[model samples]
Target: MTTVAAPTRRRGLFATLGDIYHERTNFNFIGRSRIWLGVSSLMVAISIGALLLIGLNLGIDFEGGTQWEFSVASGNPSSTQVREALKDTPARDARILTLSNGGVRVQSSELKTADRELVTQALSNYSKVDASAISIVSVGPTWGEQVSQKALIALLFFFILISVYLTFRFEWKMALASIIAVVHDIFITIGVYALTGFEVTPATVVAILTILGFSLYDTVVVFDKIKENQSTLGREKGDSYSSMVNRSMNQVLMRSLNTSFIALLPVISLLVVGSGILGAVTLRDFSLALFVGLLVGAYSSIFVATPILVILKEREPRFRALRDRSGPSVSAVAVESVVLDEENVMPAATPNPNDQRVTPRARQSRRGKRR
Candidate 1:
């Protein structure tokens, strides 16, 4: 004849923060693998669609062009001034850049010999420099193709090396998952660039490679922890592989966040301050790629890589058997117990063969064994 109120669950940022601080977070990352994987699939599909339809905005460096560099001897002229100076010439639609060293660089489609001379004269007069002082370089499409080929070769070599190293270090499954995550990061980053029409320069390529390394580092850290826990805690306690992976993820979640935060700060600074405020075109190209790549890299390492690893691992007979034996409730309780163990707010759980919480089927089996 008595009614009791159920305890309310914590919600919102502060509660989540408290849970994280107290190491009482029991996030079911592995259990919700479908959601994470579905989101990634959507992103990848959109990225591929964009690539097929819109394509990347290849810069003058990749597309080949005529470039002119000159420093003003009189006064600093803004990009508008440089543009106006070229208005009467054949290079009217040229891309003008303000260099950090108080110089201006102009790029346009390859011009004829007479047109090039005329443009040089125009830039020289605008900057009050001798015609000879203005430097001009022309790149052809062949050169751009060569650059593309070299970059692709380097990327392929990097992938091969990573696959071999990771196979030796962990297993082929981890390597495959990590590589897939890295590719996911790349596609997303490239899709952003294509959608935004950002120029794909050499600097962007360099930043993409750098972020891939950072993504790999994060994935390796997580995989190492999972391996450690699987061999020690998981084996001793007979926990499922996915459960061990989930625990390992919770353990390293904070560390991953801190690393990503630190990595993003300088990149954001470079993008916002260096490029946006200071108007450095090269920095803009470099930092933009780094910013996008780092964010997606962090995401793929956590959501994409580990989930894929769990899926691949659960296919193995040993892990599949463990998953089958644990069942849903046992797995849930096991994850909660991990939180309790870390928080130390509750007594350590010990297995009891006759525990009432055991399923009726398990109890029946025990009774049959006793008979």
Candidate 2:
């Protein structure tokens, strides 16, 4: 019976650390299945398509509109009641969203002094029970537009600077791959907002940009391992570049999981606690997007970025030259030989210098010599 060798196990923290630093063997989740990778990439592409078609549901902060938040301690107010109260107000297309702590948030396209008064009076109906419960906060459309423009400019600058930095730190190909992954995460997060019709406030922009930075950091970690593995694996015989990349991904997979888990803890807390305490709907939007982006970011770094890179690099003439220069080419040749049955019935044999002519008696003599 044939037996298989067991895989080498990594032992001790120091050994594992050494392996990570030296780009030795490790395990990765995406490395286990190409089918999963194909599905994830397709999903990302679909998300991008949706974003391009419908665009994000930009909040008043982006397109210049007024936003108001009112705190009320009444019996839980319904959306219908809030709308009816402010029905005749100057503000057009008013929206009311319920908060976790039984408070209601009111927002509108734009507001005037008269509109504010009407809103105050309508809200006063609930305030009669608890006079100090309702508080109104408002931001002008001009300020919203300026904030939006600045946020967009900041995002553009961030993308350019990060791309340049990654190119310098790793390779241009890795940098491009990282950037594409970031774009994928961004579009998916934006699509989530659009599909669910979540408000895209200033806070949402901040969260998106933060996730972009995090995604880059994760991609860089994987690429750094790939770079090291490329150098080491090149020294060994029968190790393909694709195999080296797969090995590097496996090595860094644990690190990626640990990093992602640590990062997600805070974002999850913000999503749960910030909404309860802060009474800001924007917090939920921001945290949700960040959470989703982080997950997609980790996935892209492993599957999308590295696989795409292997596909690209393998196609290059330089890599082909390297493969050829590093190894000898084989040529086909033909030779004649003889075979003997168990009863020592020998097949016909031809004499050739490259082929051994073994007679049945000679085979017995060779077996005796081995014994």
Candidate 3:
């Protein structure tokens, strides 16, 4: 008997691309892992509960308070000692924080003109402090409330506009998924503030909005790619909508990473260098939120938005058909063989028996002429 050799398997371009796409679909970090989603969601719930109970610690910008920064000689002056020295001042709700350089910063709520003078006089008891170092900044409570309202309005408007635009540009499924991802990033950022007890200010609000915009931009890019792939791959056999979406997401994953890295550079710099050079606490707060939000946004774009979209699109009839057609047993061979002619070649017209039909009058005339 003669021995026969088995044919070696050859991979095609589409097969290689499909393997890459399928490999990305199983990403445990950002893919639809039940364990990760459950853990993250539980943490998010805890953070939300803490936020509800404690709320945000609104800063002078939002609560209408006075803040004074004094640079005293570096002598490890305790916060308690500073507070005690300024106890005689006529400012209520006073707080003293120790600066990195052993200096002191004081913040108080509602001080009169003479009260400011008394604060200055009281600070003289501490180590050599210049009078000009005690500059006071104040705002009225009514103005603070107005600022708070405007911030809320702007956020609401931003969300509404984003939702409408996403829906128009892509689909309602994508819009809903993007908005949910936004909410996820926002809540996590706010929760970090609540858990760490960071002061929320106008600049913080700006940072939050900026993060939302960045997150939405990232999600939109992914969704736009998904939309293109959906239109192009809708008729593909043995490929469900879910698979197409996953493929689209994988294709753009690198682009998302590159974009996020570029955006995070400046934010990280502000967090590190700006904080040290300028001694501006606001930069630290804003950058902290931005950094965390950026990370969460990237994650949410992949896990939250795409998974939710898969769930939503699966509800459609056409998607259901695609899903039914895309069974595990289904092979590329089957897909190609079934749709290859329609896809790569034109269909030949079949002769119709009814096409030979003529009007009754013409048939009757023909019969009479023949007779």
Candidate 4:
């Protein structure tokens, strides 16, 4: 008898990257879902704790204040000079920050017209800038309260509308799961903002609202795939809800990542150059909230949204029957292969999450195209 060599298959240098981009890679997302779920739960817990205890730092737009802005040829005021200017005055609690436009921003609790004029005059004289260079504006506590109320109302309405839409468009369970994911994103984003002591302005509110849409788009991409996969589900044999969900996720994973990356590119530029370098306080406040929201939004759609949906789906009578009848597929078995070294291909043991002995998605269409 002659000994024969077994031909081994080799993965190319860019095989992994190509697979991911082309929706051909197999990742055990549903198999490892519990880990991801636990991670998300822990984050939400921390965020909620921070929100209840620390609270958000509201901006002048939300809290009543008198704001004065002006330019000085000699540059902005130092903290020492700002302190000296407010010394022995009711406006001693004022905040002074430098603007990118070589101007100074002065803010304090509500001041009477006389006091406001006096404060402006003092700053003008100290900076030796023209009197006309100083501009002052007042905001009432009542108005701030109103804005806060309106924001809350808008948020409530948005939630209601989204829930109804998701319920009808997909299924009730998907709707509920999506809500949980959206909530997760919001809580984390708000918590990060609160912890950073970033001022919550109207611009920040707008950014947060915008995040809901982005999160929804990412989530819908996955859910739509899940629904499509569900159609072909019963037609084929050996398909479990877990495996189907995992397959759907893999199909849309790369598209989600690409979309998030493209969206973040401009937002990052705005934060770094427009806000940090240019010192545009408005842009800073706006960009900070958006940056956090965009990042968390992207995260929740995959890790937070799909897992919840799968768990919910597994509860249905139809899926339950299919899961009980089916076993793992050949593709599911091959999915176990993972590269160990540049040239060494290793077959990983099936994770088998259930104590009773269980297993794992086929690669699908790229970028969520219609079947």
- Runs of candidate 2 with Cα error greater than 4 angstroms are 1-37, 49-55, 126-133, 276-282, 321-371
Cα deviation at 316, candidate 1, in Å, is 0.6
In model 3, which regions exceed 4 Å deviation?
A: 1-33, 328-371
Query: What does candidate 1's lDDT look like per residue over 190-223, in tens digits?
Result: 9998888777889999998899999999999999
lDDT of each: 0.85, 0.70, 0.75, 0.81
A best-first ranking of the candidates according to their lDDT comes to 1, 4, 3, 2
Q: Pick the candidate with the highest TM-score.
A: 4
Residues 1-371, candidate 2: write the lDDT tens digits. Answer: 22344434325566655555564534433233366557766787777777778767777666664555555554666777777777777653676777676667777766677777677677667434342346655666788779977997988898899878988888788777777778878877887887777778888888888898898888889889988887775576645556667667767777997899899999889888886577557688889889988988888788677777776776778566554654532111111111110122334444455666656754344354444
Cα lDDT tens digits for candidate 3, 139-233: 87888999999999999999999989998888788899899889988999999899888778888899999999999999998888888887776
* Candidate with more favorable, higher lDDT: 1 or 4: 1
- Candidate 1: lDDT over CA atoms? 0.85
In order of TM-score, best first, we have 4, 1, 3, 2
Which candidate tops lDDT? 1
Clashes of each: 0, 4, 0, 0
Q: In terms of TM-score, how similar is model 3 to the real structure?
A: 0.77
Task: For model 2, name the residue pairs that clash.
Answer: 26-250, 26-251, 27-250, 28-250
Enumerate residue pairs that collide in model 4.
none
lDDT of 3: 0.75
Candidate 2, residue 155: the lDDT equals 82
Q: Scored by Cα lDDT, where does model 4 land?
A: 0.81
TM-score of decoy 4: 0.83
After aligning candidate 2 to the native by TM-score, how far in Å is the CA of 79 from where it should be? 0.4
